[model samples]
Target chain A: MEPERFRELLDAYGGEEQRWPAEHRQAMRALYTGDSGARADVQRARELDLLLDSYRVKAPDLTQRIIDRVAPTGLGRFFAWLQPTVPAQWWRPATAFALPLLLGVALGLSDGSSGASTTVIDWELQEQALLSVTNEEPWYE
Target chain B: MQRDEENELVRRITRGDRAAFAVLVGQHQRALTNYTRRMLTDTDLADDVVQETFLRLWTQAARYDAGTARLTTWLHNIAHNLCIDSFRRSSRISFSDDADSTLESDDAPDSAEHSRERSDAVRQAVASLPERQRSALILCHYQGLSNRDAAEILDVSVDALESLLARARRRLKQLLEEFHGA
Candidate 1:
């Protein structure tokens, strides 16, 4: 690599060879090893890296704080417990079909024409009766 | 944490599994706190932002799509947003005084006072960077995120993210050099 390109890589990736892009690592390492000027560039980058390393922050008891803040409560907790244990793949499809299944069962139970076993003939008869009522002569006449 | 394990924990968290959430908190708290601190330059504010980030994770767990990004990246994105909010709030207040108070209390260990002084200088230099550059460095250099992930968190292209990193490092080098010379 040219000197300018080498400096740009060092600035972008820092002194650490491991942090450099994998494709450029072998060439960069060879260049750094074979050239004195490249070694100086690495040294400069290393100094900056060391300076950057000093900006550490300590996290004390933060886990408990976060837990307390996000802990589920009341109805949230109850619903969480009530959540099904079924695998998502199975439960999702089942849940998707559940409403329609319930509606069909409910319609069947509410049907008075043939008790709980209403047939297509029963539905047709009910439709005919409704039409006959509408078609009757007007009471005013 | 392994990707599969984290993904499983996220699923459990969506189900309101406190234990799973706690595990995730334990796993990422340090990195998140460090990132926030670097971004905001206040330990207390960083902790607050980190706390809010986890809380958001709990409340929005169902929104997490592992197919789009890793858990760490998602967490960083949340924390980054919180940090931005905090910055806006701080901007409304007297930031100079608050920063001074925070820096005063942020003293390092007494035994290493000299190193601590150097550290403080470096910290000040970092804190002086613009918000985006600081975030770019925190995500890529400190939090060890890949360029693409950091860019995603910042809502910028990878090339833009690299430019931010380059400018940040250049400015930091200049600041450190001036500090050392002084």
Candidate 2:
């Protein structure tokens, strides 16, 4: 790839890709064939990739304490523990049944002739969303 | 039935089945923490993010749509959002022009001469990458997520992932090459 195109990639990929522009991908992919000329460039990129891989930190230990504090040992009792600190209404679990029932209905609807037009609701999005919820970072969702 | 399994687990948890939720947490904790660590570059923040992630899961278990996506995807979505949230919460600058030049460090994780040399160079190169690029690369290259998956986790498109990855690689090579030359 030319220096100009390379620079464009830096500018383009430097930001988060969740909202990445479509045109940039088409343009970049066209030249990403690992061609002879691009070989050198890609080699350099790969080297960086390997190095970055080395630096990637190991995942933290997922012991019981971490899990306990996060998920809480018991919802009812835990919320009961928090009764003094938080509102009592917050612990109610109405949505637990309602939401899943609604989703189940959606799943049932997903089986009809309209399946072709229906979005699969890509697993990728769900993972992202749940991760967002789990991590307490609602904004990313 | 992965989605089905996840949804069932969620339902079980909602019914006050702590064991069911523990199973989910057990399944996801490592991946979630690793992804957060890669994104935040801070152990504490990663922990906080991971904790927040599960907390959300505990609460949102009901709202989750089983047919919409896989349990893993839902989990990733939670962690990704928090990473971004923590990133913004702190006033840390996103990139450092001087970050690449400081490739020297005394702490080394590898013992072999060749391993030490290369790993050290790579470590510095990764540390020097502009924060976002470093996060992107760590999750994709090191954490073993696909570019598309990383992009989704980071809330970017595949093209954007390639772009960030492309630049991250370019800068990493440039930095490592400089370290070796020295």
Candidate 3:
């Protein structure tokens, strides 16, 4: 590769710290070893790339609210459900989960001490329902 | 199972199969989690984003047309949207909150001792880049994706991705020159 083009390739793929895909390595290696100027440029690019790659920052874990916010939610999904024509079957289950989720929220907000009580009730109810379902269909059976 | 399994799982999800949705979640959660962490920086936020990302996958699985892109690309698209939003929200909290991250893994390969200073300089250079260029570099270099793939994921023209990287590299070189000198 010519010097300018070689420089570009290094910019694109030369860093060890930069995650070079396996398929690109042979081509990158070939370019790196092809000529002296090219080799020097590639070496520098690799060093910079690797160095940047080393300064790792993990994006914080997303909150459930954000996820719930992004995807069509109980109300958002409900509005979609309310369209003139009847909707698909899958939507009903989503709404089933969504409506209660919304109600749970509203209920939580309204009562002065509702937040703690509601969560406990919701948890217990879910536990009993889960236990009942599991009893109905044993894993080993 | 691999692609075939993913395809099957996708089909089942389309038919409203929650179990298949769970399987797909298990398969992709790790990557999505990692991607979220890289973009958001807060472990808690990353968890929420991952959860939300999967929930999106569950809901939108029915609409996923394989012809548009691979499962991975599609997932990255969802994650990217979330990442950008989070960055926007968090931008208010930290004015200079640019990339000065610690190493996530001990197994992070050998960069020499002096490598840390160079890396910091390069990171500062990278932080000075425009968002798109910074993202392109992160996706292409740090994530180790191909130019074509990174371009597609960035939803930019290939030439645009190249130009972005070119400018980014030039600026980085300039920044490092001054840093090294000083």
TM-score of model number 2: 0.57
| Native A-B interface contacts kept, per candidate | 0.40, 0.32, 0.32
**How many angstroms is residue B79 displaced in model 3 relative to the true structure, after the best TM-score fit?**
1.1
lDDT of 1 by residue, B9-108 (tens): 9999888799999999999888887787778766666776777678778878899999999999999999998788777767632222344233323444
**Per-prediction interface RMSD in Å:** 6.3, 6.8, 7.0
State each model's CA lDDT, in order.
0.76, 0.60, 0.62
Least accurate 10 contiguous residues by lDDT in model 2 chain B: B95-104
DockQ-based CAPRI category assigned to the predicted complex of candidate 1: incorrect
* Model 1 accuracy (lDDT, Cα): 0.76
DockQ of prediction 1: 0.18
Model 3, range A26-118, lDDT digits (tens) per residue?
666677676677666666776655455556554443333332332234455444333312122356567667999999888877875644544
DockQ winner between 1 and 2, please give it.
1
Task: Give the residue spans of candidate 1 off by over 4 A.
Answer: A1-3, A77-141, B92-111, B178-182
| Positional deviation of residue A104's Cα in model 3 after best superposition, in angstroms | 20
Q: Output the number of the lDDT-best candidate.
A: 1
The candidate 3 chain A region of ten consecutive residues with least summed lDDT is: A80-89
Best by DockQ: 1
TM-score of 1: 0.71
What docking grade does candidate 2 earn? incorrect
Q: DockQ numbers for every candidate? A: 0.18, 0.14, 0.15
